[model samples]
Target chain A: MATTEVVVSILVSTLIGGIIIGYLSQRSRMCFVGGVRDYVLVKDTHLLKAPLAFLIGAVVVFAIASLVASMPTWPWFITKSLMPIPGAPLAANAAVPIYNHIILAIIGGLGIGIFAVFAGGCPLRQHVMASEGDKSSMLYLLGFYIAAVVFMAFILPNIQIF
Target chain B: MTEQKERKRIIKHSYLIIIAGLVTGLIAALLQITAGVGPPNAPVAYGICIACHGRDLINWIVNAIGGTNLGYGTLVAGVPVLTVVGIVAGAFISSTKNKEFKFRTTKNPGVSFVCGFAVMASALILGACPLRAVLRVAYGDAIAVVGFIAISVGVVISAAVIKVNARRAINREVT
Candidate 1:
């Protein structure tokens, strides 16, 4: 297929996939931050189980599909490979860029995690909620997209922080 | 006999839903990461990344408006935006069909908006959505671990604060 054709095909596939996910997520009330929050605060495994199920499902499918795609070799199983720890023999040439990964990934992840809860849900949850006419979610997406645009136009250009 | 029969049916129905969810999740993840698809119109800072999807998409729009990227990079005309749009559309359709669609307003829109800004900023910084971080890790992206651990820690810390506040509220009421 041509590049455009492939792009079209992928977009359609992604759309349908998104629809399916949207429906399933809606039906299941899939909210990631809420799941973790419930698990931690209330000892409720109920909501937490949904994300776990999705994670397991996605991981299995992704791992298999990665075989079909030309890609980088994965550097982890369940954790950062212990063998690649700084000062370890493999650390010197390890695929993991320790400094960048530590700074961006950790800080970014913490931001997403904490703010998602504060926002009441992650993007997936918020978008769907927005569609359901949740005013807060609608307001949230406004900020979400604007921040994204600003980041690309201004923040990224000035700072080489990935 | 009727109670037992109902219980069994509920369990069976739930298992079916789970299987269906798994199938759809797999298909969606597969399609999103298809190698058949070419690169975005502009130089993408990242690929197959959900957090950056919105950013790339907005950049595409900006480039389109200006008719050129002004040398920042080749700005693409599009990204995986349709998928994000599709998600909302599908959920709306499903919810409407299921009679679960409702208009709910939060008492605190300002708070939600600020939190939303933070969430977007963090996701952009991390370069992937926390939700889809699972797929990245599954692909053996070791860098995802730092984000994952940080996210979990964030959740735990917030949960602790929430519990403390709840206890404080209870004490005030009792006193």
Candidate 2:
């Protein structure tokens, strides 16, 4: 297949997937942290089930796609190697370190967890909510976009400790 | 007698939750298998995430501002836009059918804004969020796995803080 055809097919598939996800999320209220929160706070396990469902769904679909369609499963670079994009500063000369850095990992994790709570959703939740026509979610997404720009331009440069 | 029916309802709800969880996991695993390790081929990341794409966007922006010639992150960024557009359109259709489309707000707008900033910033720094992070980890991305663990810890800690705050608010109300 031509490159453009592949790209188009991918886009179409993604759109279909996104649409299905949006519909499911809207109907199911599938928020990852929210599910946990609901279960913890009220003992209501309804929300908690969505993430589990999503995971299971993704795994099954991925397995089938891999077996029949020759779909790529698990990119090797993300795991075993870090391809230093020619001049990128963040690109490491060595393999990206994998494990045993508990402190930094914990700190980063805590930061994400707290922020998700405050944001009233995780990244996945934001997408789902945005799909459901939440104007505030749109605003949150705008923040996300701006932050991405800022991180690349300013913050990343200053933060030597990654 | 009525309590028995209520108990049954709760059990059914629990069953639904379990089923959904299984399905979601299966789909996620499938996506991982299909996308492989290199850049995703279709829908450009196979419903992966905005964070990874956003990281590429940042890389492009950095290269542009620094006047260094680099590959544009358009493919990564553009896919999310398409997916999100599809999502909004889907939701619109669903909401219209269900008659649930209404503008609403919470009492704490400032908090929400801060939360949004923090979430985006953290996700950007880590190079992915929970969904993408988990997917990456499943695919054998070590950094992503670390990031996922970090996010989980973050969530648990934040939940604790929220609990405390809620308690304080309750006490204030009582007084």
What are the TM-scores, per candidate, against the unseen true structure?
0.80, 0.74
Judge candidate 2 at residue B58 and give its lDDT: 51
Instruction: Give the C-alpha lDDT of model 1.
Output: 0.63
**How far is B43's C-alpha from truth in model 2 (Å)?**
13
TM-score of 2: 0.74
**All candidates' lDDT scores?**
0.63, 0.56
| lDDT by residue (tens digit), candidate 1, A40-113 | 87787655655566567767755665576643333344344532112111122456556765667687788888
DockQ, each predicted model: 0.41, 0.42
Off by over 4 Å in 1: A62-97, B1-17, B32-50, B66-81
Worst 10 residues of 2 chain A by lDDT: A84-93
Categorize the docking of model 2: acceptable
Count of backbone collisions in candidate 1? 2
